[model samples]
Target: MKFLFLITFIHILPQCSGNPLSRHHTTSEEIKREIARYSDIAKAIINLAVYGNAQNRSYERLARFVDTIGPRLSGSKNLEMAIKYIFNALQEDGLENVHLEPVKVPHWERGVESAMMLAPRSYNISILGLGSSVATPPEGITAEVLVVTSFDELHKRAQDAKGKIVVYNQPYISYEETVKYRLLGAVEAGKVGAVASLIRSVTSFSINSPHTGLQKYQFDVPKIPTACISVEDAEMMARVASRGTKIVVTLKMGAKTYPDATSFNTVAEIVGSKYPEQVVLVSGHLDSWDVGQGAMDDGGGAFISWEALSLIKELGLRPKRTLRLVLWTAEEQGGVGAQQYYQLHKVNISNYDIVMESDEGTFTPMGLAFTGSDKARAILKEIMQLLQPINVTNIYENGGGTDIDFWVRDGVPGASLYDDISKYFWFHHSQGDTMTVQDPSQMNLCAAVWTVISYVIADMEERLPR
Candidate 1:
């Protein structure tokens, strides 16, 4: 099935005649003509970072910081440390007006958590409470387990759920679909008065560590203790319950919410020489889940954006329009940081030429996805041709990332660097998502592509007519 989809996509590639791969040689006069006519600043930025040694050093430095600092859960002390680390790094990069904009963020702490079966057979289970989950009572909630795979199923049999712990046994097929269960399962289960809810970890791969993410509570529903069990354990429980054997689960969690804390979004810019009033923004969320250092989830994205801007400055390349880098805060809990930024700076959005975000994990560059008018698309296509040498040739529509959607909705053109996502979902919210899991070489390639895109947009004579 995957092969068929690949073949179909390849066949349709010809419909987009501007694809750089359709042409043979990079040095060909025709290719050179395209490069010269279209500003290749973005591509140059990418090339210098990917192929040059300076960018490699930057990656090494940032990776070291991420590993040593560990997980950066939003509103946590580690997140505060990460913010300072990035702010200092940007200051040293010759960026102007490097500062943090204050943002109010929720503080949720994940303390000790454990779950086990005390039923037909005794066995301990691996689990982690989702962010923002209410703690189980001190004695813990021990009740017979009722498992259902979807909300519809739970709704149909909610009457049978009283005085029982509900286990959401759904399997996430993709990131987009799986995320729904991870984010909403608790609330759905809570609505029916389930003593507690255990959701199957939302990852394609099975491992001992349970995945964790944010969950929402309905206004009227009593908040219930919710946690995610490892996929392996979830399957084991499902098998035992299918045999008509009674299954009792004991869940203990120390999760709690404290008073809202103040955090900040770090911002830095390189003022444009000719069109300083016009702005081109590139960003990534600085905050991450309190697991595994968040290296692959977003540390790579934040570092890549910083490195891209630093490269342009080092090369003495001053863009035509101001280039801004935003290291956003509180992206994990909700898009609170991004929303606050838009509200605080809505006036600036009109001058914003384009916005790009790289929240996707660092992997080999595939191409770019954009959301803009036809004229803007045409302009980007012209610039994308220069990136063909680095195997980043694919370009598609729908270019917004989760954090950048605000800008796109406000009419600023948005783009997201595309990467091979075949393995992205496996470790997405799992504890396995550490810096060691990332490919340094591929991350460097991403940095190259992002630098090129930022440079092109910043150097364009106008706003690409979007």
Candidate 2:
């Protein structure tokens, strides 16, 4: 069965001057009325997802996927298993044009690691080594610990940083502001010759949990072992330093980076009945951090994308444009898989109608955050009204996902799910990121949002302005 929008657009098509790809698609006034006509079709799609066969299905599938596959760290055998598992599952679902594209991803292992405070009332400090960080010497580095609040303070105390273990207790301002200390804390400390560095985890809310993520190393600077310490511990050590109490610590890590490993960008699609070459892409990274179940970070996002295809197929609703799902590999390693995908598919960029990603946790539904031209926003704005039944009719501008940032930056219409994120960072990148953080009803609403928006855009007779 065709998307109901095709029937609604039959009379509306007379108002458009040219083909979908032509510059003269629809006049502003004509588009306004034409989009309003889609309300019924939109309601049908939304109803089929929120109240029909797809209810809670995405959440159940996500739980099983993450439970069976655990954390899918890049280049691990576990991630390979996840790719194959989904490759088979997509075929089983009968999605058309299912395939995998090869890409080389970083292979790094976080071996046995720990930290101990030998002075100032001896105790153990929880630590999770940052990605791409080098290991300490076999005996580990034992040095006087230096606690500073920020990079400015470290530079002012450069003399004290030498031959010491620098600990950054920088206050959590925001993830964007605080995360710099995690991503480049070692490089900054190395300038002053610190033997090692420990950054307070970059999170606003924590129960003494340490979050691990990718860190950067400069080529010309000395590389030192770095890890994230619990917020509680970082504060305690800072108070000890304020009292002029001697703080000493020993750090040991067996972190190693092997040569790049071959991985894949898992792919599946529902081919268009009309213009198959024109595409509306939906995606989330299949790869995740090694610590948690990855259910919240992207397991939810990836499954919701699959659910988009699943729901559409279940309803027997085929769009006019192909809907493609690319489960990215090594996205945690700085969008490596997505960047490669962009390169391989950019020649067909002209055919890309829009791209969507849901890296943010699938929580309560709000609306989409779009990045595109004013005309595109107008089209999206009208389409968002269809979600009134679910109360997710808002549309934020200039927001897109990390994995799809490249496509948006190059002038393609891009969107990221914008929802309630109050507790999102609480579990991000920690062992706290598990299926418990997910709610089935919330995922159903999220899947409905992704499906409604993707399918409506794909089936619309007029193309969105780029």
Candidate 3:
């Protein structure tokens, strides 16, 4: 870490006295002109990723990866294989400093699970046990159902919730808002004395598909069987309850949590030509829930990050600062791998010029969501102008990286790719997140956006103001 800062110092010393990157000495005009000078570099990156040999490369790579590795849940053998696969690919690609960082991650398995409606006419319900959920007894939990729309409503009728299975049929306002139920439904249900919880899938549109995600068990409350049911099943129970009909359901699950398993974050980089210690980071998570192929959730994001480095390497463009690609593990389990990486790397946080992530689906490219000082934003906006050929230059404020959030919160500039995610939640965390949902042309556009922005920033005259 000291070497990184020393390299930056040595590289900047000769030009430091009149350095154009000085926020205090340099005016906005200088920043704009300096950023404008990179237009040619950006255009080259865009052309190569979108129209040249690299076009559609990310899509093909992702398809092949997901088809082979399949779903890679945290602490699972599949995830380990996926990590080894990526490590080998990085080494084969001849990327610099390809290595792995070990971290302990939670290992939770979803064993055979089933739910059946026993009252108000027998019916079978499609269900997915939430991550880390406790299993129902061998005989299963059979009881009347208490349907509620929101936490407030559940609390209002807490007395009736006792000794029943609570079904949350909350409307899908948005993933950010609706996901709370999936994350906390079990705890709330347990608090109200419910034996089990059946949360409505956190999706806007579902065709009898149930989405599963990580949920927490509050040690203060008793652990109960928790799972997500299809939107159709949830609504049907609500309608039946509204009609004054009693609903009884039997829930059985064999889910279990074992001791933490060792996992690794796959890492590779393009070493800098000048300031090898200074770094610009790009990333995506490699692990996903054990559903579908996990392609849409993060396979698209991860491959595109790798593609960015590949594009720059093929173009013979060498940035002054190291451009590192980190394929995070256990991101689905609340960024466990990233948290550990942060702990190991934050000591040299000053050397991190910028951090970029692309966890959201790599659909059609829009622009970028940035988190940094106004001066940095101004520089980035001009830098983005180089992408006019592809028309993905807009910058929003709400988008940043989950894995890189720690660094951003600690005052480093951060970036996340902004794209069309109108239908992202529809397949998120569900069995529908397969490779079939990916489009080659769209992946090409997204890779273009990611490559241009990341390459330009790394090779810029000065790092963005922090």
Which of candidates 1 and 3 reaches a greater lDDT? 3
How much lDDT does each candidate structure score?
Answer: 0.79, 0.89, 0.88
- Write down the TM-score for model 2: 0.95
1-466: candidate 3 lDDT, tens digit per residue:
0111110111111223433344345555665676778777777877887888888899998898999999999999999999999999999998999999999999999999999999988899999999999999999999999999999999999999999999999999988889999999999999989999999999999999999999998889999999999999999999999999999999999999999999998999999887788889999999999999999989999999999999989988898889999999999999899999999999988789899999889988888888887667776777777888888878778547779999999888898988899889889999999999899899988888888888888887677776
Worst 10 residues of 2 by lDDT: 1-10
* Backbone clashes in model 3, listed as residue pairs: none
TM-score of each: 0.91, 0.95, 0.95
lDDT score for residue 57 of model 3:
90
Which run of 10 residues does model 3 get worst, by summed lDDT? 1-10
Q: Please, what are the lDDT tens digits per residue for candidate 2 over residues 1-466?
A: 0111211221122223434555443566677676678677777767776787667888888888899999999999999999999999999999998999999999999899999999977799999999999999989999999999999999999999999999999999988889999999999999999999999999998899999999999999999999999999999999999999999999999999999999999999999989999899999999999999999989989999999999889878899999999999999999999999999999988788899999989999788888876667777877887889999988786557778998998888999888788899999999999999999889988998898899989988777776
Can you rank all candidates by lDDT, best first? Answer: 2, 3, 1
Which stretches in model 2 have alpha-carbon errors above 4 Å? 1-20, 23-25
Query: What C-alpha lDDT does candidate 1 achieve relative to the native structure?
Result: 0.79
Tens digits of lDDT, candidate 1, 1-466: 0111111111111213432222332222333354465445655566677776565755586678787788888779998998888888788877988999999999999898888789877889888789899998888889999888888999898987877889888877776787788788878878887888888988878767788888888788888898888888888778887888889988899998998899999999999888787788888888888877788778888888887788888778888888999988998887788889988888866678888888887788887888876656655666676677786756687899878898898778898878887887677777788877787778788887788777877775445444
